[model samples]
Target chain A: MGIREKPTRMDQVQSWRADFPVEYLYTTGVAGERFAKTLRERGMLAATRCQRCGVTYLPPRIYCQRCFADLSESWVEVPLQGVIHTYTVVPVRATGEPSQSLEVIAYIRIDGTEGGILGRVAVSPEAVYIGMAVEGVLAPPAERRGAVTDIRYFKPILS
Target chain B: MARKRESSPQNPHDVGRVMREIPERPRGTPLKDQDIREGKVSLIAWKPHLEYRWDSGVAISRFLLGLKEGKILGVRCHSCGRTVTPPRAFCEWCFRPVDEWVELKDTGTVNTFSICYVTWDMKPLEIPQIPAVIEIDGTHPRVGFLHLLGGIGEKDVEAIRRRVRVGMRVQAVWKSPAERVGAITDILYFQPLE
Candidate 1:
């Protein structure tokens, strides 16, 4: 009914390393359909607008959370340019191993959109700063997948 | 004649009237398969990886350690006099904790099996995989764990696929100790002995 006290570290702890592989497919419902379609065909970013609340979501949602209104087809193509809202420089991978070089991640709010998208920053970490102007760099048209990766990364827009 | 008074707040008669007045639910324009195939509608596909770890805990930790030493172990329920392989800490049948651990033979008999022509991801395989439940010799007759079957009937006749069946004797083909990590994978697969 009760656990006994551990005699020693070796007696109490034993671990077996295992790598169980799992994969899944995520569906981006009604709102995502319009957003992804625009990205794949026109290489432009789209967002959903809540008619009642006046809130625009970049990773478009199918409904307004606050009003519970269905946003089935309210799509808008905002400019593919924006300023960096925030950023981070990480020299370590998700697994905690040291990366060959630092990776800069930034959230870029496009010119005409209220919210911004979080994506990789291709520019050097030293060159990255809050409020820096940047633009999306898209993959070749033929190679474009209907995913965020289609926009390869964002780079600094020099004057 | 008796007249009805105003209804109680808890029992609102107007709820059904409101439901009858509301519009029916609407379905979105469903994207047909052709829309995705022909680029008529944008369809994004994502492959997400779920990386996770599970702790084997007390009973399984000891069982796996035994496997590293090239032995199979089971927990014994002294109350029911039954031994279960792929050991459990408690007995479901007897509703009591197992009394002791018993080492079982590496050899076993096939309880049931399947010849798989495809991989888990639904990819067709050139050679079919033989997955089977092998009941260990020293444990209870009906108790067993799922494993694959290999080394069936002879190379001369090539009749292994035809002859492999339930109740066929088999043995564990252990990986070399150097490569034997403390896991179920330490014993690669079960092989038909006769």
Candidate 2:
């Protein structure tokens, strides 16, 4: 039954959707593997120091970018604290929907490390400001899985 | 070098292994699914959650709207003097812009197809899904896109492979207008025109 239909309208605009058909398995490389292993085993934060240039890297780098030298395996467990480098009030969801509430995303300069890591600051906008001291709030040891998510969210440490 | 098929006391018979006249190779051990399953190997497993919104440009936007209204549409490439389905804004044949639009008939011949036994995400299906390129009736010859073929002689792979052939006529089986989204899935499937 080949029934033909008439053209309705011409100016109608539409958007079609499909999910990104993907399952990603990432290898936490040379530096990240040990860093994550330490975080999973011990609740302390760790960083790598460049044996050549002596510059410490948080979220440890495999090599020192400044000296172009291979880094040492010397993992120094630092206190679970950092300062807010920068932040933004993300007004949208990861799904691109307008957020029901303000989500503050920030990059914190981790203590005892040159560079920092990006994390969420779970506090009111008024209470958050530049260079504010914050400590990583980790989940229980039994629930830790050696992932960045192991640190649930960062909370403001009373300065 | 001479091949060695030396025999032990168990065999003792004259043994000569047949060589296929190919280069002898070194063997490398491969990790099997069992290794990962049994946790013999240390690895991380993650299922990434992702979402994306694809922009339906000028041609596809109209094409999807047509599908919602139960119409198969194609852009007429005046530059190439031919009409192509799954409407394109540019004529790939002539390397020029296409400005004309046309509605194509539902019935067509099955140009080529396969008895796909798996879903898009590579999961096995109980009953096979037959995906085919059904050439549209009103458009130029061999102008078609990939879509599923269903309702063959029987719903089995045996019936589909033996019964479904190239040049066999087929028609679009549209979903109810209420169920039709402005997407390719609008047509539940294309069935053979008996």
- Provide the overall lDDT of each model, using Cα atoms, as 2-decimal numbers: 0.79, 0.79
Best by DockQ: 2
Interface RMSD of candidate 2, in Å, is: 7.4
Question: Which segments of model 1 are wrong by more than 4 Å?
Answer: A1-30, A36-44, A81-85, A89-104, A109-114, A119-159, B1-58, B61-70, B89-97, B106-109, B125-127, B154-194
Worst 10-residue lDDT window, candidate 2 chain B: B1-10
lDDT of 2 by residue, B1-194 (tens): 24354432335355466456655785434678886677443357778776777767777887888998999998776556788898877888887777678888888899998887788788887787787888898888888999988766466767676778888888888899999888899898888777
As a whole number from 0 to 100, the lDDT of residue A20 in candidate 1 is 51
What DockQ does every candidate get?
0.20, 0.22
- What local lDDT score does residue A61 receive in model 1, on the 0 to 100 scale? 80
On the 0 to 100 scale, the lDDT of residue B18 in model 1 is 45
Q: Tens-digit lDDT track for model 1 on B81-125?
A: 998988777789988777787889999999998887788789987
Q: Which regions of candidate 2 fall more than 4 Å away from where they truly are? A: A1-11, A21-27, A66-68, A72-74, A81-106, A118-145, A149-159, B1-58, B61-71, B95-99, B153-158, B174-186
How does the DockQ of candidate 1 come out? 0.20
TM-score, prediction 2: 0.66
Q: Which RMSD values do the candidates have, in order?
A: 7.6, 12.7
